[model samples]
Target chain A: MDFKELDPILHSQLRLAVVSLLISVREAEFTFLKEKTNSTAGNLSVQINKLKDAGYIEVTKQFSKNYPQTICKITKKGIESFEDYVKALQSYMNPGGN
Target chain B: MQPVYCFINRLFKPKFQSMQSENFSPKDSLLLIDSMINQAKNRFTENGFLYLLWGWLIFISAVSHFILLKTRLLKHPEMIWMSCWVAIIFQIIYLVRKNKKEKVKTYSDGIIDNIWMCFGICMMVLIIIVSRNNLWIYMYPFTLMIYGIPTFLSGVTMQFTPLKIGGISCWALAILSTITLPIYYLLLLAAAVLIAWIIPGYLLRKKFKNQH
Candidate 1:
């Protein structure tokens, strides 16, 4: 049986979790994501930068009440990639096209 | 024995190969997606501040207007509604602060915000139409009907049963107002605010506290 390749960018656990959260909410702040994913600031920052580099998400930084805030939003390309990844996973589960 | 081990390894090799290096199999990935979506969905909880604010404001105005009219204590019972302008200024300040403090903006939030904004604009236009046409006698029923729109839509968007019930209550009260005397219209308006805003507002506050 032939298998579809998953998007390498979304294959990792943390990255997938971030995309999944962003997909539903559309926009979230850095603190919100870090809290929800239960990830360290350092690690989440890295994964977020990677996603940004892949054009899967956009990050915005600004000051809110004298404190820095980082907001992230998923782009069209990211949404398409996420949809494709899910379809590929479905094919793996049902190789016979059931 | 060696051949049996090799056969078993060969059978599992493809499955292991299909899994991510982090040991997340297809099933695990799907589960993660489901969970994260739920987490994001549940993260939004309404504090019900605005609902209670408007609800109490309308409720007090209606009741007080009815009392002033019945007692002939005031020449202009309608003047009570002017207090709403003051509340409007307060609402603006509150919203600005709330928006500043908000860390995220969900699609549902955006839709609900627009629904209320539309409701506000509609109410303003309605007041203008009624005043210009001298249709104040028919105002209560019409106002109640308008109240139902946003209340119902917000309930559906948030999946909150109380707000849905409140919306239905507003419509029922509107129908009842049409059959009653014009003098009693203020009471019906009071009832609408109590049901549609106050009760749901309190319940929403409780839910927000519990969730937070």
Candidate 2:
């Protein structure tokens, strides 16, 4: 098994997908990321918390029209991690698995 | 008659009335709050100063142009030309200063907005210079029409109604100036400023201010 240093929690396909989407989207609400990743609220919340704890993404809560809001944005550290992940993933996919 | 009756009855009948159900709930109230927060977060992430700069410059210039144009004293051809140059100098400085802080790739829309403002300023200078060449007096109104075209285009492109209104006002005044008194040019300038610049500027300022 060709493997490289990767965050165990983020190595999963779904979390990786979530991080990728967040990086490009500037900022996304919990609902939008849920729809985009096709993940349930419980699953996404757990993944987001993991990312937030890692300092890869920042989550802010606010009120809009008397309703609670949670917005997620990818951090600079997150962007760096994503780039590294892509490079590592690329190495794994190469013909010789270098 | 029976077939016609049957067709009419079929058309009037509500299809899928039984299938229609309110089983799904509306979007969560919490999501909207999150969205607004998200929107704010994104706005902050983007170049906030530059967006304000682009929005403010267009609006202020439009308003100032309208107000100054309305004054009978400013209608003096020499005064108009002098004021035009001063405004240009100020704008060139503003543009240079604003450019310093702006990162080219981060705010593309702001760059486009700045381009339009520059075009408007350049056209104003050209209009003033051409008016002095008595040889082009016959063509002066035409030049004015040309001047207004950029304003109109900028307005439409930016979705700022005032600029569009100003542009139309210029064309109308260009037509009106040919037969009417020179003082009428002043009046037309007033209309252009009011319609194209001042009102819209006020609206934008209010809009962004509320967002903060």
Candidate 3:
């Protein structure tokens, strides 16, 4: 039986959680993601930057009421990669491919 | 035995690295995805402010128009509807504040916003057409029918059964309006707003509070 290899980028807990949340909403603020994932600002910033670097998500920075705001949106590649990752995970559970 | 152990470790080392520091299993990955998705889905809560606002506004307008017309106390009972312009201003302010406060945008929020905008445009066009042709007698029935469209679509979008039922009730009231006297049209309009907006508005508020 052969098991499909999962995408390395999405295998990490924090990165996977961020991607999962982004996929569900049209766009989410940095604070909203931090609250939902329970991740520290430093860690989430690093993970989201990794996702942005991979072209899996888009990050926009702007000022609202004189305060900096960060918004994140999932890219088309992100959705496709997430779907593929799920399929790979499924293959591990059902190695016979039935 | 020592050489065999070293070989196996080397073989699996790359796979383990790929798994990253958290090293969660495939099942755990699936569970995390499921839970995160659910959290996102459940995050939005409708305060039902607009629904209640418009619902009560229309209800009051219709009832006041009926009473004034019946008593002949005012020469222009129709002028009572001008209050809606004030409401329109208030609604704009409320929406702007809400947009500033909102941290996330859901797909359903976008869709629902468009739905209500369409409803607003339709109502404006309908009122203009009725007034231009002096078709005021047919107004309530048409208005009730228009009320049902957005309510029904919103219900389907939000998966709220009370709103669906409220929408159906509006259509039923619309049909009944045609067979009744003109004086009773105001009553029908009031009933339509009560069922389609007011009832669902309160229920939505309750659901939102509970979720929060």
Candidate 4:
């Protein structure tokens, strides 16, 4: 009778896209995610922080080739949440009885 | 979920040029997810440039070796493979540059790199094995066998048919080289590169360009 409630952490389009991209790759740079999401630095930084706060992603600050690099990686918890979110989405889309 | 959580988080505090995605419906969310996943799936550019470079270099080298052997022109025929050593240096430079240029490193990329690394190790071992024992005479046959391992696995992983077929072709040529005389092994090497590396290299590059 009622649809499943989607996780708010994954509900937003930008955040969801970030998670989706991270799921495929082992790790990605902050700049790489920014480039892929096509979001402004300020905005991407904010969204990344949100995901990090939720324990869904691990952001590491390191130096590569004498330049500061921020790398983002999805955690096991993140993958589980993403999979659950997709299932909820499917349930809502299907409106099934199974 | 309530919008109260958004207030606590530092995210969504600043309004953006396109904040519409911040508040989207289920259908909109679905579309975004689809596009994002597809974007990740479509990244298939790796080794196309090297394949062509190595393919042409080795192809020419193998052919030259065959010609030298047939004509008895050169006092030292092993000099042809020396070009491969130089080409290997160039390949290293190219790979390092490409690694730096790649923004996102996918899981498949790591696996592919390992496969090629293993191939390199095997090649080194073959060189050692050949120098020590004369029984494993026709070097190309053994080389082709080593070549098939990575090429076939690479094709299987990427699901690229040309590579898979090329790999099979290499194995077949390796077997053929064993049955025939050592003189024909060079020709077999040429054919293997043409089918397994050069042709597939061009096709992969074409596919990459078409996607971009």
* Highest DockQ scorer: 3
lDDT of each: 0.87, 0.55, 0.87, 0.83
Residues B1-212 of candidate 2: C-alpha lDDT, one tens digit per residue: 24433332343235313322211111221233235334333432222233244334433543454456566445543333345556558767876765433211123245446666776677667756766765444444664576476667756655667667767877887888789665345455545445555555565556556644
TM-score of each: 0.91, 0.41, 0.92, 0.85
Model 3 chain B worst lDDT run, 10 consecutive residues: B1-10
Query: Which pairs in model 2 have colliding backbones?
Result: A69-B34, B66-B193, B162-B196
Q: Please give, for residues A1-98, the per-residue lDDT of candidate 4 as tens digits.
A: 45566787787777999999999887888887887799899988888999999999999887767888888899999999999988876765565536
Question: Per-residue alpha-carbon lDDT of model 4 for B155-192, expressed as tens digits?
Answer: 98888999999999999998898688888898899999
Best candidate according to lDDT:
3
Measured by TM-score, how close is model 1 to the native structure?
0.91
What is the clash count for each candidate, in the order shown?
0, 3, 0, 0
The sequence of per-residue lDDT tens digits that candidate 3 reaches over residues B102-135 is 7888888888899999999999999899999999
Q: A14, model 4: CA deviation in Å?
A: 0.8
- Candidate 1 lDDT by residue in tens digits, B71-139: 999998889999999999999999888876777789999999999999999999998999999998878
Report the lDDT tens digits of candidate 1 across residue range A1-98. 55577677787778999999999986899988899889899989988998999999999998888999899999999999999999977866666778
For model 1, the DockQ equals: 0.55
Listed in order, the DockQ scores are 0.55, 0.03, 0.61, 0.44
Residue lDDT tens for model 3, A6-67: 78778788999999999999999999999999989998999899999999999999887888
For candidate 4, what is the DockQ? 0.44
- Whose lDDT is higher: candidate 2's or candidate 3's? 3
Worst 10 residues of 3 chain A by lDDT: A1-10
> Which number leads on TM-score?
3
Between candidates 1 and 2, the one scoring higher on lDDT is: 1
